[model samples]
Target: HMTNLAESMEADLKVHQKPSPVIVRDALGIFLSILFWSNHRPVQLDNLTEQIKTLEMKPLNLEERLEYVLKRGNTFLGFRQLNELVLEQRKLIAKR
Candidate 1:
C-alpha cells in the first residue's frame, strides 16, 4: 500500500536528522496529498507503467507538489489509510 511511502518518509527524516518540526509536517502533508491525488486520478491500468515514469518527474518539494495535487480536485482512495498515516506522524512527532 501507499502507506509504505509515508513510513519511508519518516525513516528518511530520521536518517537525515531533520532539525525542524515544520519540515517534517510539511513533508508528511505533501506525501499525503500525493497519495490521495494518485487515487483520485488513477493511471489507466493499460498505461500504468508509462504514467508512473511521468509522475516520477513531478515537483520534488512539498509546496509545489501539494499545489499540483490541489489543482487536480479528485476524491481520495483510502480515508482509513490516511487517518492511520496521520496517527503515525503524530506519534513520531510526539517522540521528539
Candidate 2:
C-alpha cells in the first residue's frame, strides 16, 4: 500500500534527510501507479510492472524513472498524487 510505503518513507526522511524524501516519494508513486493500474487494466499492469521491476535492478535515475512513469501512469488520481508529492517535497526543501 502507498500508506505503508509512506510510513517507511517518513522514517527514511529522518535518517537520510538529504535525498530520502523525494526518492521515497517517487517510489511510492511508482507503487501507487502499479497497484492502481493493475486493478484497472491487468494486461498493461503486467507489462509495465515487468519493466519497472527490471529497472529496479539497475541504476535508473529518479528523473528518468519518473518520466517513464509519467508516460505509463494513466489516471487523474496518479497525476494528482504526483503533483501533490512534488509540491510537498518542494515545500519541505524550501524549509531547509
Candidate 3:
C-alpha cells in the first residue's frame, strides 16, 4: 500500500509541478515516517479535507505542510488508496 501511495504521489507531482521536485522529495520523508512509525489510527477524511483547505489558504510550502501533517498524524492510518483520497479531496476543493 505504501508503494501505491508513493506511486500515486509520484504521478501527482509529475502532473502538478507546482511544488518543485525537491519539495516533493522532501515531503516523501513524511510519508516514510507514516510508513514506518505510524500508530495506525484511521484518519478522518473530513478532518483531512479541512486541513487541506487550511494549508491552501495559508499557501504553506511543502515543508510546512509536511510538518502540519506530521503533527496531526492523519495519514498514518494505513492509507491503502491514496489516489482515491486525492481525487476525493480534489472534488471537495473544486466544490468551493
Candidate 4:
C-alpha cells in the first residue's frame, strides 16, 4: 500500500520539469490536503464505517505461517526482543 502511494505521488511530481525542495514540499502538501478532505467525504457505500470481526475470515495457524516465512527468506532479526530497541529504531528512521 505504501509502495502504491509512493508510485502515484511520484507520477504526480513528474509533471514538473525540475526537482527541488519546493516541488517535494508541494507534493507533500497536496497529498496531505487530499487525505484531510478524504476523511470528511461521505461514504457512498454500505458498511463504510463498519468494524470487521476477525471471525468473519478463515483462521490460519500463525505458527506455521511464521515458520514458512522464516524458512523462505532472510528476515530482519533486530528489534524483536526489546521494546526499547523498537523505539530506538523508530527514532533513527524518523530522524532520517
Candidate 1 lDDT score at position 10: 48
- lDDT for each residue of candidate 3 in 5-37, tens digit (9 for 90 to 100): 456545555675333344344444544334222
Angstrom error of the Cα, residue 7, model 2: value is 1.6
Give the TM-score of each candidate.
0.26, 0.29, 0.24, 0.25
User: How well does candidate 2 score on lDDT at residue 58?
Assistant: 25
RMSD in Å for candidate 1, one decimal?
13.8
lDDT ranking, best first: 2, 1, 3, 4
Off by over 4 Å in 1: 1-18, 41-96
Error of 3 at 81 (Å): 7.4
Strongest candidate by TM-score: 2
Between candidates 3 and 4, the TM-score winner: 4
Clashes of each: 0, 0, 0, 0
Candidate 4 on 1-96: residue-level lDDT in tens? 323433443454466322334433343334323322334443222332141111122113423332332242122221121212223333544554
RMSD of 4: 17.5
Candidate 2 residue runs with Cα over 4 Å from true position:
17-39, 43-65, 68-96
Which sequence of candidate numbers ranks them by TM-score, best first?
2, 1, 4, 3
Q: What is the TM-score (0 to 1) of candidate 4?
A: 0.25
Cα lDDT of model 2 by residue, 1-96, tens digit: 555555455454456433344555565555545433433433233454455454322222434545554553333343344545444444544554
